[model samples]
Target: MIAIDNILVSDDVVREQFVCDLAKCKGGCCEDGDAGAPLEKGELDEINAIYDIVKPYLTPAGIKEIETRGRYQYDREFGWVTPTIEGKMCAYGYRDEKGVIKCGIEQAYYDGKTSWKKPISCHLYPIKISMTKEGEVVNYEPRETMCRPGCIQGKKLKVPVYVFLKEALIRKYGEDFYGVLEQVAGSYFAKAEKQNK
Candidate 1:
């Protein structure tokens, strides 16, 4: 436990860099190609709204499958991407002309139209949040997952995520929402480790 704490604390302190060469491969994180990513609250709303709009365009059975699927899970403790629909890539995942997996929502945002309404986890790529038990945030940290090139990198190099979450509250939501999210992230982090182990 002490070692885990130390690694977590120290890793959160120093930023790490990994440049993804998407040209070398199709989007590794696309659908079954890689683990999914965590979704943010606003993202959920955006996706659901898109679903309502797009469902009419899909086959009846396809719409049924989506509606019958279980409620999407959101782990608040440790940040983890939500599960993707079976037999499909991420709802917002797409391939560019060069066959790179591009984010639908991001493109939408860039085009000045209704974006895919993607999760914050997707928006704040390479950067993650962390929190502590007493309801205090730890800091923000740089995550090393490979992503498309030209993504934004931040200074403060790395900070404790939970700590940063708390800090972000003033800029976004109030304490009550962030407090609950901290617990969710903590739980998700634990679950991810157990699975990997």
Candidate 2:
């Protein structure tokens, strides 16, 4: 594990290559999960504050779900999460013209209707974060079947997971943390290469 401040990052985060192939996956991550996207406590307020502005970007069904159940719901296993549409897709997501599921909140952000993007968990996907007794533990956990195209694409393009998720990482842990992670990754990969040689 690579220690960055209090967060313990799995080595696979630096070693594994991954770049989302949206065309192939069709944003399955948004629709396939059992529960809706995990939400941080502070994000609940953000979602509530922006719901009105973001409503237009969502599907009618999604809007209904949100209105009926409130902005966010509590889950026994996952604590706070965005509500799902009848246990299917996230209520905050809608199918685009291409039939690909997309985050309505993100669309609203892109349209400048709202300043906040989607949840941080959704932004930093394939990297699951869990709070441990010590600190936050970050792990690389790509969906085996759903992420096949991404895996192939990443390997072909030679983009490591850390590099692919640079923006999200910076957003989550600040630029300084990411800078240290990049340095650590460089040194780790170089040492591995030398050993292989």
* lDDT for each candidate structure: 0.47, 0.92
List pairs with backbone clashes in candidate 2.
none
Question: Residue 106 in candidate 1 has what lDDT?
Answer: 56
Off-target runs (Cα >4 Å) in candidate 1 are: 1-21, 30-35, 52-71, 74-88, 115-117, 134-197
TM-score of 1: 0.46
Ten-residue region with minimum lDDT total, candidate 2 = 92-101
Per-candidate clash tally: 26, 0
lDDT of 1 by residue, 1-197 (tens): 11222223223322233333467545645554343566555555666666554443334444454467522444455344544546456644666779777665556656556545356555443344455463423233332344423123222333233443344343344566556555555665688679999
- The residue-level lDDT of candidate 1 at 167 comes to 42
